[model samples]
Target: MAPEVRTNVNLKPYRQALALPGLRPLLLVSVLARIPFTATSLALTFYVLLELERGYGAAGLVGAAMTVGAALGAPLLGRLVDRYGLRPVLALTTVAEAVFWSTAAVLPYPVLVGAAFLGGLLNLPLFSVIRQSIAAMAPPDQRRPAYALDSMSVELSFMIGPALAVALATSFSPHLTLYAVGAGIVGSGITLFLLNPPTRGSDEPTGPVGPPSRRAWLTPRLFGVLAVSTACTLVLGGTDVSVVAALRDGGEVRWTGLVLTVWAVASLVGGFAYGALTRPVPPWVLLAGLSLTTIPIGLGGGTWWLLCLALVPAGLLCAPTIAATADTVSRLAPVGARGEAMGLHGSAITVGVALGAPLAGAVIDHTVAGWGFAVTGLIGLLVALAVLPTELRRRRIAADHAAAERAAPEQTAGDDRKQSPTVGGPNGELVGTEH
Candidate 1:
């Protein structure tokens, strides 16, 4: 006799999600990858300062290189994922990252920047792949928690990575810190490659391959979500530049790092503590509120205390909005298209940062630091208003579905008697739909 598959409909909700086999591996890989990704941000600046006698500008350039590469490369890598499976592609990317990150450890500033750019190119699709995997492997009700967990992991990396980099740079040298980061990324990548996350073993079946290409990305739903995400990120991206410039102006430039560090730490706290209670906030409204709240960033609270106070609310928006976007994407995307959906979402983030930085930097460099915040706030307002109608429509659809589900009968003796012959469930109940 064949072994009967286990079943447990009564499983505790939280426990049920935790039972998902692929979830932990996905989280592990995410945390590991982000270690180097975030730490490098801190280390690169020190590398420029120590070896090349370059200023913050070089560090800024390194940040731009990483963002630009990730933006350009995600879509292509995503397309490849649709054709090939994740394992080989992941292994190849990881190997390239390993090679480049190690080499970058000892290279001169120019060489290191070039290597960093290359590393960014090779690092494409990892985050999107993991997100797509989580969507495929987790149960429907469990998806929100999965995304929450993933967002939290990102926040964790942001919190710990720079701080760790600071400690290492203070104790050892920037080169040594870079070497350590390289080793960590390589080791983590190898682990992910070896364990191969469940997505490696088999392909998730996507019913009826969607459109011919990613042409559907321009569709209203995705485009709308992308717009909101980008707007939200612009607030974040622009705020970083504005704050840095303002600090520079106030002769508190050193505090720029500290303020950013504080912001990241607050974000970390918010992510871990975001429980199931926040589900009451509809995704669309949540996104708009998050974006709209960012308008305060432009407020010239010149004192450090006021600036710090302003950041907590601004920082709070970061993970929650991202989690909302992830939730929306998971529901809307077809199975195989998750990677592309996530890639596009990631691209929006990169584009926001890229656009926001230079635009704000120009204002600061030319006019004044404060205008940087105002310009980005306007962008945020535009994106939020543009996407509002769609968010409302989605909410209505969800409400109607919930109402339908509520009215459905759970069981009926008459219905049971009318069950058509064919398949039988494990409990010997008629499983086929009644004609």
Candidate 2:
């Protein structure tokens, strides 16, 4: 009597992801986390400009305050996750966020900055925990797709949050909008607390991750990844500066917000599209492609026409590059230390962001106007080329290892049959063992 039996093959994947008891909860929790975190990029600049009587120059301070807190938080949180399970620590974070945001909402200017800094301290760890949760719960093949979908979700959130925040803060009170953002953050932190994600860390772990995590920044591969990711950030940062300056030079400074929003929106679409690829490309290929595409971003001068299209490629590049990085981190993580790994990965990103704007600004100050874009694009291209051979080797190694694992069981069974005691003459051991 259930409405005409429908054999629906399309529901297979949805069914599977849904079948994961915790996925929906995690997704819901993630939505809550994203709204406020992204709102910072969207609203704070306006808050400073409009309410605090600060000019555009204050934007840098706001960004720096948040990021420096986050940079310091990353390692601390990663260490926490390594010591305690993700649940307890994440719960504490949510409570901290609730307190910080609520107090910041009513605080004075100096107090507000302090709150923002503390919020940053509490913020960056959320995403890393979420990443670790996905790795813990998802099967091998689904892990990449899950990460892809998460990236897409964040992209979509960014596209929406910034544009909407700018509009709402302008139309209404900036304080009102920021308060709303604070509420959104608290809600997400609570959600994460409730949905205790699957744990990869064991009670009796194999590695040395229990009490105090070792000073692992000395590891070579970790350093290498940071270098690569940091380079990518510099390219993006430079591109941001170049476009902003070019727009000002062309007397289209007002369009800066609009152009950036458009770029974020395009990236939202591209990330979703990238996630949908049937046979997902390896991270290296996507990385190289993403790096090369920076050419358009750097080259698109303030010609009104190029503004619309130049950033599309850059936006499009965002999700794929991140998705690839997520994959690489997953593969690189130790069995029980994914949370720490993700946090470290996040810190690298923060380092990149912190380094990027200044690097671009310096290049622009001393050089030709157009050199900003050209230099950034060239740097990206060179990085792509320099890393290609290493990436190729890594991929080859991964493939070979995968092949060996797939063949191991069959090979083991065959060997067992040959060496196992046989019943050739009713004395099972004599024929094969000769004992």
Candidate 3:
């Protein structure tokens, strides 16, 4: 007899998801590919500062150029992927990125700045591809876990990537680190391309037919998901700034790194636990939890150890919120447009961090450091609460429209009966319809 497939509501989802054909390799390649992404900015900063002997302002400008490039590149590259398929896009980007970095190390400061911008613009949309693939391949029930796994991989990359860059740059030369980064990108990109993971099914479009509809895949629900993701990350950025400032104030600057690591670990653990469950928490609930938990963190500014404990609740919500947003995007985004959707999702995150840190820093400079955490938490909570009413109204309208559609056939049938001509006698029994 054939063996029966194992099943459990709690544990089976993740197991089954991993068991899906071609998923594991894709996941592995995705993680490896993204390591360079996390490493690049830090490495670039060090490179410009140390090797080129540029000032912080120049380094900052170069970094900003990269960020701008990434923001612009994502949607454009994603659209290309949707139109032309993954392999060609990945192939072109891989070649371009490899060449860009290889040449960047030898270029002058003026040229390096422009090169950085181009590199960012042409950076392979690895994260977008992976998320889109997971959304496409995983069963609907298994997606939460799949996305959660993806989020955890991202967390791990963040944990390792920057540190690795710093270690390599500090120990060896920054030029060597740049070369290593370029090599990593090329190697990972080639592996993923050759593996040829199933990004979309046969039904999905491989190329564009004509101009897209005016009301395209970016629906209101998807917009809401992106907005919530941005808000959550913004809060995270603010929290980071506050924690560092508070630690500095308490003369526990040395403990700041440890505290942040612990905070990230909490988020990683939360992602694992959230993914294991059969049911996942809603994005709004996670957002609320994140905001609520952060409020108490500001209260611990006097004691660094106390602040570490306060960070736990907010940190726990981090990965889950990210995972939940990914899941939401999967559900809300239309089939052919998922690549662009995922691209937009990543952009939202970058934008959030870009906005949050500076705004929070400004707040800290203007007021006390502790107020940064408080204001960040409050902003997140308020945003979530404010969006709730609009979301509710949209959902209600959708439900009414759906109900009307369901009732439409019956209403049409009834009207037809009322308008039908009667061939029978005075009893008013309708026997025939009008010719």
Candidate 4:
């Protein structure tokens, strides 16, 4: 008999992914956990600027310290999760976060910078953990929608978290605001510790199978995905700075929040639609489209609303591109090393954001704000172009290797048959003798 075909024709993709056990709670907790994580940077900036009475340059330095620490620490933390399991790593990071946030409000400038770096080193690996959990909870076929939902939740968090942080900082003392943000971060960590979502899928072994070496899973294809991820965030980060600069130049800086809100909403809508697609879109294609669309945004810098409208195309690609990258990483990484892979993905994101703001700021300093968009978009497009050939070559090699492997078995069977002696029976039936 032929194999049976099972189809979920009536179920929506998001619904199907959500229907899986543990996924809903996991996603909910992830969103909640990420809100404080998102707020930390803004809150720290406010504290440095308002409470410490420092210049923007000093604030930028503090932020840079944290960014550098996170970039360096993410992969190491991920490796720890892979080896020691989730709870221990979470606990350790949680304690570290608690210590930093509790004392951050009182530290001197130099001390705070060092503390920020240390705090970032042990920063709760919320992004990686959430992604790793999604990969664990959702099957390969269902992962796109799951990751899409994850991306949307991230957008939602960013929309809410920084705004809330800013509000508290403005309304209350920056010192009090820092305490509240700290409380939120510590709370998120504690919650994650208690929840302890699975990092490996059901099909994947629970116990240590001994993770493969880095070279085994970190292929050129994986690097390409990471590069695309970095490029995507670089564009986003530059766009952020450019938007503010453009608005300030137009004397409509007050409308900055509205424009950004529109952009975020567009991304949410795009993520929703992308999740429902029957087939996956490649990350490279999405990145290229994002870059292409982003390049024209500067043309609309004449007005805030025009900029908002111009941002729609690139915004639409944001969540989908991110979701696609996460999905690709999950597919590429070995189960044993997925935590590390996701961590590296997080590092790529951090590096991109770190680079984007400065690069865009430098451009906006020397040239017009509009050129910020043009230059950043051009860089992203160039990167996408550069990575395309490598990705294609990798796919071709993988295909050839798969085909050769498939052919080997058939070839061996044919050789065995040919080597066997054949005889004609009395009834004219042919019989083959085994060697």
Candidate 5:
């Protein structure tokens, strides 16, 4: 006789998710891998500024090249992963990362910018891969917690990676810092290549099945989720620039890291709590909350501590919103097309970040730094409002379709009862249907 398998009502969602086979290692590797990935942006910015003796504008250009390349490449790389297997795509990207980072320091400015673009084009699809794996590994019920965990990992990486990069770059030779960053990235890529986690669920087809047409899966609802995904990040990216501007204006620029760390901690806490909830919140609702919370942050920009305090509400919504978006995309996309869908999700993030900083910067340039927060938050709010109606309509349609499906079988049985005549016995008791 087997022992009773009792369910614990008090068991947390994270624990339940981690109990799944292979999830723990996958998430662990992802967090470790993302640290270097997060570090690259800041490291590159410093190298351009300190080593090349270039202006911020030149550094921005290099960063823009990489961002654009990443935005354009994400879907293409995901499609490659879908067409080819994960290992081949990983191998190709790993080699590309190795080559670019290894030679980046020695390249001239023009060459460096071009190389950066190419490097981004072939950049490892780590973000997409991890999300795809989570979707594949975790059942639908378990995905929210898994994605929440992933978002928290992201917050953790952001919290550590840039600060570490800044410390190394400022304290040591920028050249050596670049070398160290390159080494970390290469090492991460190799580790992922070895791990090679599943990108499709066991029930999903693993053999050669041509991916479905975009029209099949790229429904209006999915597009709305993607739009929300973009808006969510736009708010975040804008807030980052706005925070810096606000700090600088208040003559508290030196404490920027501390304030940002506070904001990240709030997000981390939010993600953890959201995962434990028995019911899931829609991404649009979370996005709206995030945007609304963000709009009022400018009111507290007078001091670094005040700014940190102001950021808490918005930060609290951040990881939850991000996790919700990832979960929604996994649900909406077909299993075969999940890789590309996740890639598009990454692209949306890149686009949002690219747009946010400049938009916020422009607002700051024209007005007070506090207004930058207000404007970006307003934009995010507007986007949320725009998408809400469409999302509702889609849900209504889906509900109606489901109701119709449910009613069909019952209606057919009723019609059959009406059409058939029953034979009666002498005592007026029903015996059988007419033959």
Candidate 6:
């Protein structure tokens, strides 16, 4: 069936994107896969504190170890996907993750930390794979809407996954919840393996084998896209730290969760609105919007309500920034290297968070809570500016290269005709131009 085409982004296109063949299953499994990504940390924290009778300090360390493992693993797994195929890599990781989680449930505290790290390191790169699949499966024009929907789904997952994990852990047994989460991960992994979406080399190549080209996948344009994405996440991470600080300062630490929820809801709305626009906004513009909106959030120091209000404008830009960056990464990455590029994009996000949290906490410790927001926002703007020239130059070069390639075939055909003489008479006389 011919996929529906749209002149503008709207509700209809979003529906159409979902209805596309092969995409629905992918999206469904992707959401399932993401549950563990969002839920496991919360579940682990609870498991350590409640079941093992450990301190929050121990739980935090374990969680940090898991995150570090995932961060380190994402790019390597993506590179493997690019070099080999998706199914084998996913299958291996699926088995590893299931085994790790199962073992983790029974291990001692010290051993459990290491197991969690290994599990996270080998965690199925389902989210990265899904994002790459969307780029591969969706038509060019539909990608904007596709990415928007993708971003929205992630937000929904964040809202549901962590809360569900905590509730189940608190109401039931933490160990049981961890087992359940592991089972869900296994199911998601199996589903993805069965689906076996295509990567660059899924089919046999037509050309003869030779030395690989020295060209790299991390082109400057893609680097810019990744940078913008990292900056956006950095802002969010900093906001998280600053929000906690602000709430604690005001003695309303309990309201921190509520305030963040409000911020998240605003971002969800922004994703919908951004998706519906006829033209997607540029990455720089979205980043600028975020920085400008975020800068004032620090001024809302007195109460949680004021902080919530200040966050609304910045929150509105969050999903848009993410969606735009995803779309840009899809566009910038070559077909052969899409998996690795997307993996790097995912890595950029994790790195941003890893750095932003510590940076913001340091700032807050040295100065006041509000400066965390101010400092992060200013840094984001500076990063946007720093990459502007390089991004512009890369864009121009890419456009020129594309233009040359487009004209090459015509030029080659003309030269071939010029070299071969055409017969002008019945005697097969060669006709040559005198001019």
Q: Which prediction has the highest lDDT against the true structure? A: 4
Q: Candidates 3 and 5: which is better by TM-score?
A: 5
Question: lDDT values of the candidates?
Answer: 0.71, 0.68, 0.83, 0.91, 0.90, 0.82
Pairs clashing within candidate 3 = none
- The clash numbers for all candidates, in the given order, read 0, 0, 0, 0, 0, 0
Query: Which 10-residue window of candidate 4 scores lowest in summed lDDT?
Result: 6-15
Tens-digit lDDT track of model 2 for 315-349: 78777667667666766666556667778778777
* Candidate 3 local lDDT, 160-227, one digit each (tens): 88889999999998999999988998888898889877667555655553425527766666777788
Best by TM-score: 5
TM-score, every prediction: 0.77, 0.77, 0.87, 0.92, 0.93, 0.83
For residue 194, model 5's alpha carbon misses the true position, in angstroms, by: 0.9
Residue 53 error, candidate 6, Å: 3.7
**Compared with the true structure, what per-residue lDDT tens digits does model 6 show for residues 1-435?**
999986754587778777767777776767667876689878898999999999988998888787788888887897778777788889899999889878777899999888878887887998888888888778768877778777877887888788889889989999999998888888888888888875533343422233233265466767778888889899888998999998999899999878989998889888888877778788878988898898889898949899889999998889889999988888877666677778888888887877787789999999999999998898889888877898678769899999999899999998777765655876878776532
Tens-place lDDT per residue, model 5, 214-252, is: 999998778878888898899999999999998888889
lDDT of 1 by residue, 1-435 (tens): 999998644324445556788777678778877877678777877877876678888888886787777787776676566557667778878788778767776677777677777777777366677777777777557776677678878877777787888899889998888788877777766776776654322455633344355565446888887777677677777888888887777777767767887677766555544434435344455556655655665565445556677778767767767776776776776655666677788788778767887887887777777788777777777777777788678779999999877666544555767877778789988667777
Q: How much is the lDDT of residue 377 in candidate 1?
A: 72
Alpha-carbon deviation at 421 in model 4, angstroms: 11
Candidates 2 and 6: which is better by TM-score? 6
Using lDDT as the measure, name the better of candidate 4 and candidate 5.
Answer: 4
Error of 2 at 249 (Å): 3.0
Candidate 2, residue 337: the lDDT equals 61
lDDT of 6 at 277: 77
Question: How would the candidate models be sorted by lDDT, starting from the highest?
Answer: 4, 5, 3, 6, 1, 2
User: How high is the lDDT of residue 157 in model 4?
Assistant: 95
Predicted structure 4: clash tally: 0
Considering only N, C-alpha and C atoms within 3 Å, which residue pairs clash in candidate 2? none
lDDT agreement of model 5 with the native: 0.90
